[model samples]
Target: ALLDIPCYKILMGCDGKNLQETKDLYNLTDAEQELLESKRRGHALFIIGSKRLHVNFEIPAYKFSYMGKAGGR
Candidate 1:
């Protein structure tokens, strides 16, 4: 199900317990796996291809935006 969407940055969960799942999803290296285990709370990897960036964000792009005033029904 998660394989369909085109994602720019994928948030990799910080845990070695789920090592295989994480590896399959992100294709993490040995160094990356070590780093993943060292992550503290409120930190995660922003996976962009082979590059593992720090900042993580989710897609489907839902956020507050200013629209015109609503007309009374």
Candidate 2:
């Protein structure tokens, strides 16, 4: 099943590769990196923030395991 959120939010993360460049440019807080690393290997991390809460969604490893799997991706 797919997870549904109620409202809109801003998501942030390191764009992988050139970690140093991303850090220098974005200046992400410790909390952000901490949150990203919380996910297991082979997981897609979504860092969502809004008026009420901040959250991370670690997508399942297999695309078929979730609903609306991306563009046969």
Candidate 3:
């Protein structure tokens, strides 16, 4: 499955409060929205190829905060 594959690029430090805004801004599908909504902190995985693909995965909220503090280092 696409979700089972490891992603090449991982997007960190998403603000849960902006889930709706992010969904609206990105035109996320219902599945994506549900995935994002499931956790207070999550990261998005990107598998860019001939077809661009993305999926969200849960992470510790503190990790998200740390990523932000570290400027995504």
Q: Highest TM-score: which candidate?
A: 1
lDDT of 3 by residue, 1-73 (tens): 4433543544333446677676665566776676555553444534353233555565766766655765566
Q: Flag clash pairs in model 3.
A: none
Residues 1-73, candidate 2: write the lDDT tens digits: 1223534433444345544453443355666555444543433334344232344455666854675557555
Task: Give per-residue lDDT, candidate 2, residue 43.
Answer: 35
- The runs of at least 3 residues in candidate 1 whose Cα sits more than 4 Å from the true structure, single-residue gaps closed, are 10-13, 56-73
Better of 1 and 2 by TM-score: 1
Q: What is the lDDT of residue 22 in candidate 3?
A: 64
Question: Using lDDT as the measure, which candidate wins?
Answer: 1
Residue 66 accuracy (lDDT) in model 3: 57
TM-score of each: 0.48, 0.31, 0.39
Q: Would you list the C-alpha lDDT of every candidate in the order shown?
A: 0.58, 0.45, 0.54
The clash numbers for all candidates, in the given order, read 0, 0, 0
Name the better of 1 and 3 by lDDT. 1
